[model samples]
Target: MPDIYRALGDSTRRRILSMLKQGNKTQKEIVDAFDISQPAIKKHLTILLEERMISERLNGKYRIYSLNLSILQTAYQEMLHYIGELLDEQLISLKNYVEKGEFRDEDD
Candidate 1:
């Protein structure tokens, strides 16, 4: 969970992840898409790799990166659970308000 939060904490990493989702890309290609330095891009990749959110393959001299998708599943599941709970709470609140005559009219 900490890794998920850390991986999502940086905008550069998020951009890299989004790009990788489209297709695999070499280190040079990822760096070219950003205005930052190569070393900076490498740092972001390192964090993402440690979190297992992305994977890399050595293609001769180039390291190609792609999204792992599995580890990212935890983050997505967490978000879904949170959203479901919020919606349930709101529905209960609406029900209570209606029952208590705090949000009702005779128009119906």
Candidate 2:
């Protein structure tokens, strides 16, 4: 989904996801891992939350966030499929070119 791609577009957000992949973490815990300000990290978390890449739960005074693996897996699979289709198209074009004797060898 476009949301997933957008959520993954930033290195900071990707790192946050990688952290969540290890285990659930509190907002403070996530904030501590990076050198950036808490508000900056919070913004990245918000985007991840909006994309449903992470889920949040209130625990007393703390909010815990965890990766939503199913959503991530679905997005990853779809991206792989898209990449495979592109590669397949390129290969088909190369095959056609060769078949028509139109491919050139620079060494020749």
Candidate 3:
């Protein structure tokens, strides 16, 4: 599986994903939304494609891109599970610390 985290690390890539979520768009349309050059937008689109977060098809002379909902949903669930695991670990640590009486009273 592609590293969805790496693909999502950039703001431009996130914005491109958001745009596709609304509906499919051509490369020109996507580039027009940002002030950056077409080459920069192309780079972002390539990352999204590599991560399988979006799909691209040749629509005549233009390439149309659409959000890959299933892949994105799977990534979202994985992220949630990962975050839950971290929270659980922190809670367990807090519980152990409290049980050990490591924290002193403010008056003390």
lDDT of 1 at 55: 92
Q: Sorted by TM-score, highest first, which candidate order results?
A: 3, 2, 1
Off-target runs (Cα >4 Å) in candidate 3 are: none
Best by lDDT: 3
lDDT of 2 by residue, 83-103 (tens): 999999999999999999897
lDDT of 3 by residue, 8-94 (tens): 999999999899989999999999999999999999999999999999999789999999989998999999988999999999999
How do all models score by TM-score?
A: 0.75, 0.91, 0.94
Clashes of each: 0, 0, 0
Worst 10 residues of 1 by lDDT: 99-108
Instruction: Give me the overall lDDT of model 2.
Output: 0.92
Backbone clashes (count) for model 1: 0
Q: Residue 101: error of model 3 in Å?
A: 1.0
lDDT tens digits by residue: candidate 1, 1-108: 626878989999999999998999999999999999999999999999998899999989999999887778877898788889999999999989888888646796
Evaluate residue 71 in candidate 1 and report its C-alpha lDDT on the 0 to 100 scale: 72
Locate the minimum summed-lDDT window of 10 residues in model 2: 1-10
Candidate scoring better on TM-score of 1 and 2: 2
